[model samples]
Target: MPQNKKFGTFAGVFTPSVLTILGVIMYMRLGWVVGNAGLIGAIVIIIIAHVIAVTTGLSVSSVATDKKIGAGGIYYVLSRSMGIPIGGSIGIALFVGTAFSIALYLIGFAESFNAYLGFGTTISDLRLTGTIALSALTILALISTSVALKTQFIILAAIGISLISICFGSTEFVPTTVHFFSTENAVPLEVVFAVFFPAVTGFTAGIAMSGDLENPKRSIPRGTLYAIGVGLLVYLFLAVFMAYTIDAEVLKTDYNILMKIALFAPAVVAGIWGATLSSALGGILGGPRILQAMSMDKVTPTFFSKGKGQNNEPVNALFLAFVIAEVGILIGELDIIARVVSMFYLTAYGFINISFFLESWANPDFQPKFKVKRWIGLIGFIACFTIMFKLDMIAMIAALAIISAMYFGLQRKEVKLQSNDVWKSVWENVVNKGLKRIDAQVEENSNWNPNIILFSGKSDHQKYLLELCKTVSGRTGIVTNFKLILDKENSKPPLKKIDQIVRDEQFKDLGIFARQIKVDNIYNGIKNIASTFGFSGVEPNTIMMGWPKGIENSEEYSKMTQALIHLDYNLLYLDFDRVSKFGNYSSVDFWWRETDSKNAEMMLNIARFIIASPRWNDTNIRVLFVNNNNVDVSIIETKISKLVEDLRVNVNIKIINNAVEQKTFYTIIEEESIATNLTIVGIPDFNPEKQAEFVLKTNSLFESIGSTLLVKAAQNFNELDLDLLNK
Candidate 1:
């Protein structure tokens, strides 16, 4: 595009907008609106329509001034502000709406031209004329946007003369027949508003030409607002003037009432022709730009991105838009096309307001040169959709469903937006405030949730361990996996960042926060990170690690376990069996011992978390107690059943009698849980002096079972409650 040839405010923005607004709807439909709605009702509809238009115009101006808007005016503003998914959805809708708008204008022109030729308005005649007009307009648009826009000045002059003729022709006030509200035969007010709305939507014609403007920030706000102001004044004046001069019956039935009522009927006819032709030309010029912009963003096919000449005119996109408009014209009904176009414009306008509202509310850096109250965007958003539902509920739902489908489809493409989105800032602000609120509250045992920190030395080698932690955390709790690198040189290797990235990609869907920590000693690193990892509100309450392998690091491992206990962190050591690796995921065995009730409680809670996961939803849970002290087995079973019932968990209880001394506790465990998917066993107190002995005994105890969890509670609180477990 040539820099010097870029358009200024009047030619680029004001002319196109005002011409579009005063096009087909003004000449053809305004009298019908006045006839059905009457004078007072028409004014109300006009006010309501303009309120939405003015607010949206303000929001568009605010957003445009905040950033240097690119091509695809509304699409660029929304996608840049909100993100690609939502932007793509609304962009496609806007493009389709604009294309349909071309057909709308062409159809209106054909209807008026057919009447002027004394051919009478017929479906076949309108379709034939509309198709021909579409071909001519598409050719004109293909030739040059600059040329098409330049001709809008003549259309504006014609509209001016037509308005003058209407005002002067109304020599006598002969109203008093039309009701303030609608008559019994009048269509619903919302239906009337829906048809009239497309008239005001022409303000976006200038915004669609954002790429061709020299200074969009100044041009868009000034041009768009001025056009809306002019369109509003003209519509309101015509509504009152027509209601006072013409009979309601004549206004209601005649689509050519404006020409009949004008001082010089030929001027009104010329204005109608100029208005419809220019508006169709504007749609042809603007719609393709939106498609081209989306194609460039990779939201649509790249073929449409190719443009012709120095202006990079979207010729290919224009052809596609022309095809869509042709289909709309083939439908061959004006009101049906009007309703469809109305839905598309409403969807676009609603999102524009939402985009501006989110930018203003979420981003502190969103300081626009042309400032408006943020609530104005919010109200604009509400009004646009409110009118949509009031007009047609089924169409409203269909429009939303289509946008939603497009949104999810674009999400799959993962299109990366170039500009910064406000969602990140919005979420960050929400989390910060939420954390502060959580910190201000007093800690309670009943409200305890598992915030687990896993120390995985090599993430690739610990996939099963990571999966276990993720399952227990599920969607409610928090899990952070820290890969510890023992670097003696104390250098932060670049590979560590790459490793973190790889880990993220590997488990991206798991929602686990993975980090890499370089340390001189594993024990000190664990202690240091555990001491100051997170804030008071959401600190890690559990430290998870793989079971100790050999005697070489037994002392350090034992000391770290003791330190974690001292720091009030629950410990979980997983002794995963490489062979059986959670066999079939059918059943879980919880070996409950009366001496360590705290560990039992923790084990029960972890079991609940496991069962909550979809993968383990059908897994049977069995709490087993070995009777060694000759206590009543029936009483113990009853007590266990009552406890499980109180926790609202369904589980089977098995109390095995120690009939012989030769069948050891470890032997019973090996035999009972050998075929189970998972086994939960409590961790005994770690004796620093006998670290090697403890590791060997515990490791050998779970050697024959499937994947086992050795849980150790750091502190004794109230018994596990239903609230904490369910949460």
Candidate 2:
């Protein structure tokens, strides 16, 4: 528990890692792997396994150099890089995997010990021995991590002596020829690789000690890589030695072949015992730290974050890990536990690689002192999962499904972490690059989309107007809502910030970019702002506002509308009906006129946008053309039908052939669209001198309609086409 008792590279990282790497699998399973896969095939498996391991180690190293590592080791690194949601999922999996690993190592130790008793041992006997071992190791880990790690040194010595004995030991029986490939009846190479993989996974034992290290960034990379290199050499040497020293049949049948091949048989026995116990101890020490880290991050219950004594040892978390390991021991099958543990570890390792890949690729500020090629992390990620499915597809699927469920569950919690900023930066980079590409292209009428700027006044006071603008823009276009404040006092920094926050809160879920703008005059301010509102590629091409309440500012509104038109901005004025508020959202009427074809086309586009929303998805549209000309009614109907067909919208066309003297245009609109939920009308062109008269006449035109959208096109548009609507 003492703070000054932290470990350096040798005792902290290299010792635990090498001892674990050389543990139970190397002693108990290497001969079986060599027998099933033969010398050359075994070497290939070793290389493939180490390729994944070395790359993952490199990724870990690179990330460690960039971030200051805390108690949870890989959990801390992943959560800090990828955000808490993903990090918590992998962290929980890694904790359980480490706990299961304890049971695996203990079972290995018990199997070896029971076989040494020279009795007919049953599964019950192995379980009993494992349970006892688990108890002893739990007690040792509970005392202190420093004590448990220090014990690994003695275990390391025993493994070193056993390996030396194997190299020099004499064997009476020998094969006539060395088997370079798998023997008949041998299991598949992937199956053999899965069993052998745990041998090299011990490198993380050092990484798990990140919080207890004197200097984690320096010790972790140096010690982990060194341990991997050493383990690789030892495994390769033993595979070749066993292939030449004894027959394949003997190697296949005898799990204790390492002991028999050693010059001093008892030394190999001691080594197996040391190896398994040490790896179990490593898991006992490391697993709880992961839980503790998650608890600290609020990914798990905070109670588990409580630690004991001077070093703040994760005592409560350690107990939870002990219970999980005890349950794993009750399963009482080494191979089964190994497979489950492999799946969990592979999931964690794959995400670790992904964390490094995303950090390096997305974050410009990700500068690491110990650098690795970004692709190495990517390759490692792919290889880990590939090997996982090859080992056991059902297990792989179950593991991923569990991780995914955990991720979603964590997402609902307000467990915010600074690591989530990486995604913000990623999105910014994508938007900037995309905007540059869009800027280089020429503007075309066929590519026209509504990039609207709404003079919303106050978002609370104009909720209907805000909703209409959002629905018209849909998902394909952009909507920027500006609350134009007439008072210059509101433009001060603190008040502006408060106003901005209020605007953001109001429009956060609406997907509308809301801002507050200070203006001297309402009409001039809107005219100037609408004229220069956005960037070259994604500029606001349309200006929308609610209908003026009275004729008091009719002249100012008319001048602003004229100025926006001069600046090539299409205009939309909504006259919202507070009584009906879109009246059941069932029907929409569009009044089309050939003389105002541009405004009619804009009206059609707006109607299509309205129908695209879920609230109006079932709305029926009708296009009405009052044919007062002497031209044939059938020909006008045909042209209107063709236009609707080109736009790909399902709308009924109505041709009202009546004399101009019999019914006025306003009277026809009022009678025809009275039953519809919403009506779209074209704004007539008017001179600036008669602005008040125009506003008064237009306000009286749709007095009986449920709700109306009056549209004015900036200029004549090309004929309506499929591209304009679909894009």
lDDT of each: 0.86, 0.83
Off by over 4 Å in 2: 1-3, 37-41, 170-184, 188-190, 240-252, 389-394, 417-421, 458-461, 488-499, 503-506, 659-662, 684-686, 714-717, 720-727
Poorest stretch of ten by lDDT in candidate 2:
718-727
**lDDT of predicted model 2:** 0.83
Model 1, residue 199: distance off in Å is: 1.6
lDDT of 1 by residue, 624-719 (tens): 888766667667776777777766677888988775564766788998988888888877664577777667777787677778888888675444
Question: What CA RMSD would you report for each candidate?
Answer: 3.8, 3.6
Q: Tell me each candidate's TM-score.
A: 0.90, 0.91
lDDT of 2 by residue, 1-727 (tens): 3345789999988888888888888888888898999999999999988988898899999999898899899988888888888889999999998998898899889888999878445778888899999999888887877788878888888888888887788777578888999978998887788778878888888888888899999999999999999999988888888899988888888888777778998988989999999999988888888899899989999999999877788989999988998888888877778777878888998988988887888888899889899999999999999998888898789888999999999999869886554566677778888899989987667635889998776534477788778899977899888777786555544345656634456587778888776777788879877767799779888888887768635667667777788898888888888787788889998887656667767776777788789888999989998866645777777777787776677888898876555577878898898888888888877778877776777788757777888888867466443221112
Runs in model 1 deviating more than 4 A are: 1-3, 38-41, 170-175, 408-411, 414-418, 459-461, 488-504, 626-639, 656-668, 684-693, 720-727
